[model samples]
Target: MARIIGGLTTSHVPSIGKAIAQKEQESPYWKPFFDAFKPAHEWLAREKPDVAVVIYNDHGLNNFLDKMPTFAIGAAAEYHNADEGWGIPVLKPFRGHPKLSWHIIESLVADEFDITMCQEVLVDHAFTLPMALMYPGNIDWPVATVPVMLNSVQHPLPTARRCYKLGQAIGRAIDSFPEDIKVVLLGTGGLSHQLDGKRAGFINKPFDLWCMDKMRNDPEALARLSNHEIVEKAGSQGVELMTWIAMRAAMTGRVKELHATYHVPISNTGGAVMLFENNPQPHAIAAE
Candidate 1:
């Protein structure tokens, strides 16, 4: 059976990556934030899981307004970063795992978990930024990837409960994998900040801190949080935490945080970097 090796929590704000790619993530406010990611990066290189099941939202890049599935997975052989009006100029194609991905899809579906499977999808910065930030010099990723896209950027998105259930389903699917492997469920997107209306650029430190605390200790309470509540209390448009619910649920009410960092470099936005380990059964350690 596959084991939940570790997890990562991050924000995939496009501007953040744009700043870094342009070599500008070292400002007085942002420098300290970037510095905090070292341990998370080091942890990835050290653990080197067989696959990283990424939970991220697409900004209408691949899954357009035409048909948006609340949850989707890429069972493709590879993924390329398409120019979303703004060019990356130097990024290469992203790696993917077709066989394992197909297995996940088949398993999830067999267990009555509905998921949209994609063959052609161009990942936006939401998928690329975290990888670039975490593995900057990576030419070829040491492990494969399973892209789980959520429809949080669009209106009428999935509820926090819906996302949480999906996470549980993913965990069940991973457990049924015949091969022995390590899986990392990475959740990417916002802590607290608004990006729309006159209230744009709003930052709430208190909410961000509370979010980090709940993410580590009381995830169920965190899952109970609503998008509107997050927007009104935190910001107007950056409450993408639903995707993290799925990541959190995959752990099945068990996690030990490895690293946690929070920063608000850009005005009207907050960013965070966190790491978690999922050891479902404490005694399972001795068996390994």
Candidate 2:
């Protein structure tokens, strides 16, 4: 049976993509954030998961405010990345696992989650940047992917609890699949920052640190928060933390925080990278 090996959570700010295009990773402004992924790269090298289930929010490349599904999954055989007016260079198409995607779709529907299935989806930077961060300098990606997008951009978004439940359903789906493949979950976006409104350029360091701690120690506390509460504390755009919560929920087993790093003011966002080993033996929480 297929099993989840671990999860990775990181911010997907578009400027990170531009930095990659300009080869600025080691620059003073970018090095702290970029260097944090070294341990994650080492972990991936050691585990070498066969599939990556990326949970992210679409930024108008595929869905718009007029017609956005609360939850969507990519079932296509290949997912292409396009320039979403960010001026970042487009990435090559990522190979997809249709069989696993279909299984997950069917299982989610059966679980009454009402997910939208996309056979052809245009992945924007939110999806691609995290992949690039995980597999740096690779022209071709190493693992097959499944894009699980949440609607963090629109009103009436899925509540934190609902997103957690959706992730639990996804965990069940992956566990029941017959294939003997290893899967890694990638939850992209947010620690805390706001892009617009009167609170524009906001960064809540205390809240970001608190959320990160709860993610590793007591995610249930985070899930209990209402959408309004999250926006009020984390800023409007910071609601993207739902993707991180969902990724944590999908683990469905005792998790270990293998490595984590948090840096502030990355394009007005609180950039964070956390790696978790799912279902670690002897089941004890390690100090973060």
On lDDT, the candidate that comes out on top is 2
Q: Against the correct fold, how does model 1 do in TM-score?
A: 0.92
Task: Encode model 1's per-residue lDDT on 1-288: one tens digit a residue.
Answer: 687787888887777666776787677866766777788878877888888888998987787788888789998888888777766544577778887788889988887778899997788888887877777664677667889998876677777777888888888888768788988878888777777788877788788888888888877787787777877877755667776777888885357999888877554567787889877675555555
* Index of the highest-TM-score prediction: 2
Q: What is the C-alpha lDDT of each candidate?
A: 0.79, 0.92
Error of 2 at 164 (Å): 0.5
lDDT per residue, candidate 2, 21-98, as tens digits? 899999999999999899999999999999999999998999987779999999999999987984888999999999
Q: Which regions of candidate 1 are displaced past 4 Å? A: 283-288
Candidate 2 global CA lDDT score:
0.92
State the weakest 10-residue window (summed lDDT) of model 2.
279-288
Compute the lDDT for candidate 1: 0.79
For each candidate, give its TM-score against the true structure. Answer: 0.92, 0.96
